[model samples]
Target: MILEAVVLQVKKGMEAEYEKAFRGASKIISSMNGYISHELQRCMEVEGKYLLLVQWETLEDHTVGFRQSTEYQEWKKRLHHFYDPFPTVEHFEKVYTLES
Candidate 1:
């Protein structure tokens, strides 16, 4: 699995609106090919901070498939304006894990 992580810094006072927009945007991403799941988590210690974690079957499923698709345009229209300086998205692969 591929993990796509984004740390979003929303503009002050725009958090509520951002969250609302993200709700709609989530539908766009979750429907994409190779999409496993996703989560939008709010930061308790910092105002207007959020973490967006998305799981994909492969890296290209996001970097090439989703990012290049027309759906991504809609996603950007819904959520991009809320960001103060834009978020940096990073991808990762499983290295180690422990479970009982």
Candidate 2:
């Protein structure tokens, strides 16, 4: 599986609006091909900061399948404006895991 991660910083005073928009945008991504799951995590220590993690069956599932699709445009419209510097997204593959 491919893991996509991004650290987002929303514009001041726009956190609530951004979260609401993100909720609306989640459906768009979840319906895409190869989508496994995703989470939107808020940072308690830092206001307006968020961590977005998404799992995909393969890198192409996100870099091509989703980013190239028309649905991505809607996703961008819903969430992009809230970012101040614009988050940089990175992908990774699992190397190890431990569970009880």
For model 2, the stretches where C-alpha displacement exceeds 4 angstroms are: none
- In order, candidate lDDTs are 0.94, 0.97
Instruction: Please tell me which predicted candidate would have the highest TM-score against the true structure.
Output: 2
Question: Alpha-carbon error at 82 in model 1, in Å?
Answer: 0.4
**What is the C-alpha lDDT profile of model 1 across 10-80, one tens digit per residue?**
99999988888898788899999999999999999999999999999999999999999999999988889
Top candidate, metric lDDT: 2
The Cα error of candidate 1 at residue 89, in Å, is 0.7
Error of model 1, residue 57, in angstroms: 0.4
Per-prediction TM-score to the true structure, in the order listed: 0.97, 0.98
Counted clashes in each candidate structure: 0, 0
lDDT of 1 at 69: 99
